[model samples]
Target: MTPPISRSHPGLRAVFELAEFLDHGQKLPEQSRSLLAQALQECIADGFDTSLFTALGITQWGGVPAVKKIGLLRRDRVLRRLRSRIPEWASLSPNAAAKEMSASFRRYETTRWPRERHSAKGPAAQPNSIWWGLLRSELGVPGEKRLAQILKAEIQDGFEFPKGPATVAGTGEHPENTGTNIR
Candidate 1:
């Protein structure tokens, strides 16, 4: 029988690192995951050179395939985007980043899903989505207070509201209006 591969193998090491990243909830965003999946399928159909696999430390015996490598690269790109968007990520250690990402994921889930079972009907009722009913039981917050806490923390931690359009009263035709009208 062939000798068992050691954990010291580069391919194995990379896989372990990826597993740790996933365990920490550092997953790629839905859009990025979809795009990367399509790209990987295309790459497989195109048939990459064996040398490419060799360069990535993948062998015929056992190692990450080209598709997985592509996926990992795409995930890394998403992680980079996350780091850029959250300034705190730049200074945080790996464990801290993981904790932050987990909290962010919880907040995202709370916002994306409805909090009430009966409030799944109609547009306003299903504020998150019309299909919220289907997934309501799967992802509802225990209470509004938890969501409020998450929002408060996010706002205090550098989340900024989008800027509104500038209102120049004199420059516009409505000179008397001063552009301060709420309507």
Candidate 2:
């Protein structure tokens, strides 16, 4: 006879699903959509997913209840990583901040698309590409949000920029280079 799926398996499945969702640049369920959103807020506030996942892998992977417990750990860690990446001046809730960051990143991704690919005669003419173009335009990078990601990543890591922003008309050296605070 075939074996039944263990109760413990669902938790592991959820953890894996959540992790993959993050990897693919999707947002977690909304606070209203999830009872756990409040707790997630605290995890984000604390900034500890990497450590929690480490602990789970090493010591807590036995069953569903344990996995569920670890989900909270992972969620918090995800929130924390996101919060750390955002600048302090934004002063938004962690969830909102994460959503903005995701939107901003999506915009960055869109701008990287080849113009030929997005042209009506190009790959973007496909149904999927068509939807993507629409979504990208909606998430549309405001000058400020784009600048914030560049500055935040630079200031937080003390890392050199991989590439400078695309220059805008008459903007001169990209707005990123003007006497703005990196913070």
Residue 108's lDDT within candidate 1 is: 45
Model 1: colliding residue pairs: none
Candidate 2 on 58-177: residue-level lDDT in tens? 224444334444433332332333345346525765445645655654554566444433443213222223223323333222244443444344222111122333221122232223
lDDT of 1 by residue, 73-155 (tens): 32333233343446775466545665565565455456643353344232232112212321332322223344333323322
TM-score of model number 2: 0.22
List lDDT for all candidates, in order: 0.37, 0.36
Error of 2 at 144 (Å): 20
User: Model 1 segments beyond 4 Å from truth?
Assistant: 1-63, 113-183
Q: Which window of 10 residues has the lowest lDDT sum in candidate 1? A: 174-183
Residue 107, model 2, lDDT: 54
Question: For this target, which candidate reaches the highest TM-score against the unseen true structure?
Answer: 1
